[model samples]
Target: MISVVIPTLGTREKELIRLFQSLSSQTLQDFEAIVVSQDNHDKVKELLAPYSFPIQHIKLDQKGLSLSRNVGIKYIKGNIVTFSDDDCWYKSDAFEKVQSYFDQHSTGIACFQIYDPEKAVYYKEYLKDPREKVGFLELFRKSSIEIFINLSVVDKEKVTFDEDFGLGAKYPSGEENIFLYTMHQEGYKASYVPEVVVYHAKPSLDTRLNNKAFASKGPMFKRIFNTPIGIALLTLLFLKKLNHLEKPIPFYLNSLGEMFRYKKSRKR
Candidate 1:
């Protein structure tokens, strides 16, 4: 069975409904949806009841996405675990394809394409051969919606999301990238499949670099890579995405500053 874990803030009621509707429409029905709610728990439970497949609603008092995901992981019973965002919905054949791929390939991690309905494009600008082995740099391009993991592999390695990162934490992003990195470090093999599995109708703001979100990258860099590597990566990111940021100069300086500050705090 495939266990689909979704961590939500209960804010996207409309999108959440859409997501579940898609789940109900899936060609494969051997999956359960675990909705980890951080707010409006009761309402979320009520909202999820109408879905066709088996559903589980877990309430969380905390706000961090990583924390919510960790909570969902504890309750998962399926051998294969998948993650989906509250705002994203899967294609009808997604789960079927994922299950088929894992059955054929002996990989621990499997990634599919994440398409943006608004942009009318898949997230990966460059496509490799389908079912190609993906390592460090390639894995970074993935998001939660595009990936599935064999729980047995990750459980053996004791891998979980980093609570210090992700939405609603001090760091506002890079949790998925780091999680995949951790899995790789723990000796898991990840493969990329060029199939459209999920759709991301992202907000316009999601494309831009704001102060708080950009600043989080400094610490993210330090945590996932080394501090020196983090600084270099952050610098390159800032340079390449300068036009996407409102206050490019100030944001770059503050981001580097925050990285150092986060490092210092860890020592205390």
Candidate 2:
């Protein structure tokens, strides 16, 4: 069975409704939904009450995407685990495909693609063919919604997102990168399937630049690597993002400064 963990801030009622509508039509009924909310517990309960599928709701006073996910992990009732963004919905056969992949392959974690229904295209350019291993750099761009973990193959206890990063946390992004990189470092094999299983709207450029999204990547590189290669990777990244940013110098400097600060924090 597939266990889907969805973290929400009690906002996005319309989006969550659309998401549940998608899940309600899923061809695979073996999956369960776990909704972890920071607020509006009563609202979430009332909203999900109509859905016939088994659903679990956990209320929390604190907020942070990573922390909510970590808490949801403890309540998982299935061997396969996946995180779902409250605003995103899935294709009808998404769970079926995921379950089939885990059954046929030995990969501990599998990453798939997301499609933008309004745009009529994949969210981004993904691999054209199947990949046996997702590299460090590729994992940086991978979204959490695209990832699925088979607990029977991975060490379930060690699979967690860092609390310091992600949507509501201090740095406000890159927690997924740290999560996947740590999984790879722990000897778990990851594979990418060139298939679109989820649907989400394409984000605007303004949202992409919000909450120090680019600035946090530098510190994330540090968390992924212990050696000087982290610096080398940051230089490569600077070159890539520089071509599009209106102010590349500040972006680069912010990344570099944040990385150094993160490194210092690790020491004390």
Candidate 3:
């Protein structure tokens, strides 16, 4: 059996409907849908009441995406786990392909490709071959919003989405990357299957830029395996931005000094 987990914030009703509609058309039927909402459960209930699947709703008072995901995972009972976003819709064979891959390979994780439906026609031209397996780092390099993970065979004891990273938290990214990197470090194999596709809604340019800038800083100070090259890159990036700031030298110096302090603390 497969458990499809979706973590949402009680908004995006249109997107949610699209997601559920896609699920209803899935080629695979031996799966359960678990929706984790960070708001009133009644809203989700009313939205999904018409659906004819074994759908379960989990309400979380906490506002963090990671917290919502953890709550969803707790309610999942399938041998294979799949995650999707409320704003994304999957292909009919998405779960079928995922389950097929798991059946063929005794591995820890598996993932698929995500494209913006509005830009699907250009996906072939614009999409770069993700040379590496689908994991947290690779996902970070490509996007911040969409992540697909197969957590069934993975060591559940070691798998968790970092609450400190992702949306509604201090840093606006890196939770998925951190989780995948940690899983790899713990000796889990990850596979990427291209046939399992999902269409994610694109955010506005400003939102994308803000998230990119915010996400770039996360690896510098928050990551566990911070390297010298990573630190140097972050320093150079920060210094370049600092040079552009319309502020007094004292202000820039204070900020730089604080960054150095943070680096030192993280090293310890």
| Stretches of model 3 off by over 4 angstroms after superposition | 121-152, 204-206, 211-216, 219-221, 227-230, 233-268
Ordered list by TM-score, greatest first: 2, 1, 3
Error of 3 at 130 (Å): 9.2
Residue pairs with clashing backbones, model 3: 136-177
Superposition error at 218 for model 1 (Å): 0.8
Q: Find the 10 residues in a row with the least total lDDT in model 2.
A: 259-268
Highest lDDT against the true fold, candidate:
2
- Output the better candidate (1/3) by lDDT: 1
TM-scores of the candidates in the order shown: 0.93, 0.93, 0.78
Quantify all predictions' global Cα lDDT against the true fold.
Answer: 0.83, 0.86, 0.64
Q: How far is candidate 1 from the true structure (C-alpha RMSD, Å)?
A: 2.3
Q: Model 2 scores what on Cα lDDT?
A: 0.86
Clashing pairs in 1: none
lDDT string, candidate 3, 1-268, tens digits: 7788888886888888999998899899888999998876677888898889888888778887766776677888787776677887888887787778777777666655666768544222233443245544453343322334455567555656777666776555556766666677877766555552677755643454343433435353436555555556455645655544444344334434433443322211
Model 1, 10-86: lDDT tens digits are 88989999899999999999999899999998779888878769988898888988888888988887889887889
lDDT of 2 by residue, 52-111 (tens): 988889888999999899999889899999999999999999999999998999899999
